[model samples]
Target: MWGSAGIVKPGLERINRLLSFLGHPQRNYLSIQITGTNGKGSTAVLLHNLLNAGGFRPGLFTSPHLVSPEERIRVSGRVYPGQLEKEVRDLGKRFLRRHPSFRKDPPTFFELVTGLALKHFSEEGVEVAVLETGLGGRLDAVTASEPRIVVLTTVSLDHQEFLGANLEEILLEKVAPDRGGCLVAGEVPQYLIRLILMRKRKVGGDLFTTGRDLFVWRNGKGSFDFSVRGEIIEGVSPVKGTGFQAGNALLALAAFSCVAGSVSGKRGERLLKVLEETVIPGRFEVVPGHTTVVLDVGHNLEAVKAFCREAGKLECRGRRVLVFSLMKNRDPLSLLRTWGEVADDIIYVELGEMFHPFRRIREVSSLLGVKVLVAKSLRDALSRGKKIAGSGGCVMVVGSHYLVGEYYRLEGKTADI
Candidate 1:
């Protein structure tokens, strides 16, 4: 499923069927469902950590694994063991035996994995689950979980082919699972917040929005304070310290404050500790060496723009080199132009079979205003980037999660972040 270049059917029919067969294990625990273009994984991880600090025994499920699928499903910040993984597979086999219709028409890979996560969470006696939607919330498999807390991170122009052509249309599809649950929205435009309230009135829930109900102010470099629900928690910091990550942390903290009621005393201390220690892999993850290397999986225009902003903050003695490749579905013109402003040179490489054509990138290469070079492979790209960056500069590998996974595989490193 990770390697396959196929799209799943857009609806809850298949996942609903699977959940019904499994006796709806999702209802056994409180769930927090997250959906967005960029910050879904980070928010999920943050909320999961907060819930774990509250003694919820939380299970987390996120998509586009960096190196392995095991990174997707976790219990109490640890991957579900291999033995239980086999047990879930056996249970899936039993489901196949019980339902003959599924033989002719099988559920998608994401559906099967979501079912596995839900069932495993139930069997492991998890009290809460944090689920990040694999795609749009209306049709994604995770929506069948019917989460109690719905978190919408910054929704940008991503997966437009499946979600919608415009922002309003995509917003509706992404907010479909909010069935009278506590909805926490990130820093979106005021008009969209009004649209959200208009759509959510049918299924009522108290909406806590950033910049209105929730606010954050910088306390120091890489540290800030969150003011939510008329309470202010001070001296909180996020991993990587990017402006976008602080926004992501604000969304997570807002949702956590909504669920836990108060972010103070022992609970507040535990949550703050979790935030300080949490490290999300492939989100501006820096590996120190003679030439510092940074890995990020920001492919879309909005996400890439955030990455470029963060990259500009890094102090480099030499030139900053960008190592990048994108999926075929993305338009590289805007992303290349954005990267060109921050990076001194760009090395384009093939993302195995999923590589986007170089001709489109070449057509706009002149407009980038930076040197763009093609490499034989990801390894070659990284090597050339390091050489170009020299010993005193930085080499940033960004664009897609597939590229980061390839790097981890080559280095024999586990992406347990």
Candidate 2:
């Protein structure tokens, strides 16, 4: 639904209708609903791992799949087959036939997918389902499921066209799904922290914010330690990403600690084991080979900055090349400037007419600090980037998720690792 050019009809009405028709499968399992400008996918995966370790049959649903639509739904950390999606589609068609009013006003693609995931989870006998909101909190389809724990990861200025124009407005839109439940918030901008707390106060939920109610810090040697109230889980293996991931890990751990009630002995061991094993694809994911490659689906300015910062941390023997393409609506000037500071070479590929034109980039390429080069396609860009990087260097693919999806499709890669 994210990569498509479909207009977002933000509301719970359609999804609610679909869920009701499906017999409210979401009610059959405990759930954690996560929403944020960034890190939602990674956090959802982490929480799913924790739930698995806690001996629950966890179902994870993330958005903007890298390779297949089925990637959006996973039971016990494994994606459903394409046929399952087909079955869900056929079921929807059958329902529409019975209710001509539904045919007159059909559910959106995301709503259908959300219904599919919930129904699948119910059929799979999931004990808990971790759902990452497809959009802002309140109106997103995932909200229809009604999670017991609601998590808000780092909130930033993105999706202004739909969410809001400024951070405060966007924060309101994100915190609307609190439902006066176990609301956990990650490290948001300092200014928004107070606003989130204020919202929690008004909404009357048990507010748990990182650095306030919960704390996580590096324990040296690429390990982390987190504490909630008085309990502590020490020596958690670092997540496979930039330093920012520690915050995401902490957010997940905090939410899981609430669900599981304690993180000690066997439970602590499970947490540690899951942390070391989980590798979220397209989130600063590194694939090692002749020429090292990094894939990241960071569309907004904050995400781009984090991607560049992580790319800078890599030990590159030769050139550090960046291959990227941004949506037409995004202002690439600042993003380009940030990446230019670290990248030795930058290659721009045109995905379609929907993306920002390479010619538009060429117009201000001189003004930008990076050495910009245009490629005929993603394959061409990756090839040039690998050549520029040589065997000893690195090629980092960043910007939109669509760009990363395009690369995976062209290269026949499922983004394992």
User: Model 2, 126: alpha-carbon shift in Å?
Assistant: 0.6
lDDT of 1 by residue, 1-417 (tens): 221314567778767988999899999988999987779998998888888887678899988788877788999988867654455466556667788677666666677788989988999999888999988898889999988889999877778789999889889888888899899898888889999989778899888888889888897665888887778777887774555577877888788776677887778888778777778888888888889888999888888888878788887888799888988878888888888888888889866556776766676787765567898788898888888899889999899888888999988998775
Report RMSD for candidate 2.
2.2
lDDT of 2: 0.82
Worst 10 residues of 1 by lDDT: 1-10
Q: Write the per-residue lDDT of candidate 2 for residues 134-213, one digit (tens) a residue.
A: 89988999998888889999788888888999999998888887788898988787889988777778778688887788
Per-model RMSD to reference: 2.2, 2.2
Error of 1 at 257 (Å): 2.2
| TM of each candidate vs. truth | 0.94, 0.94
List of clashing residue pairs for candidate 2: none
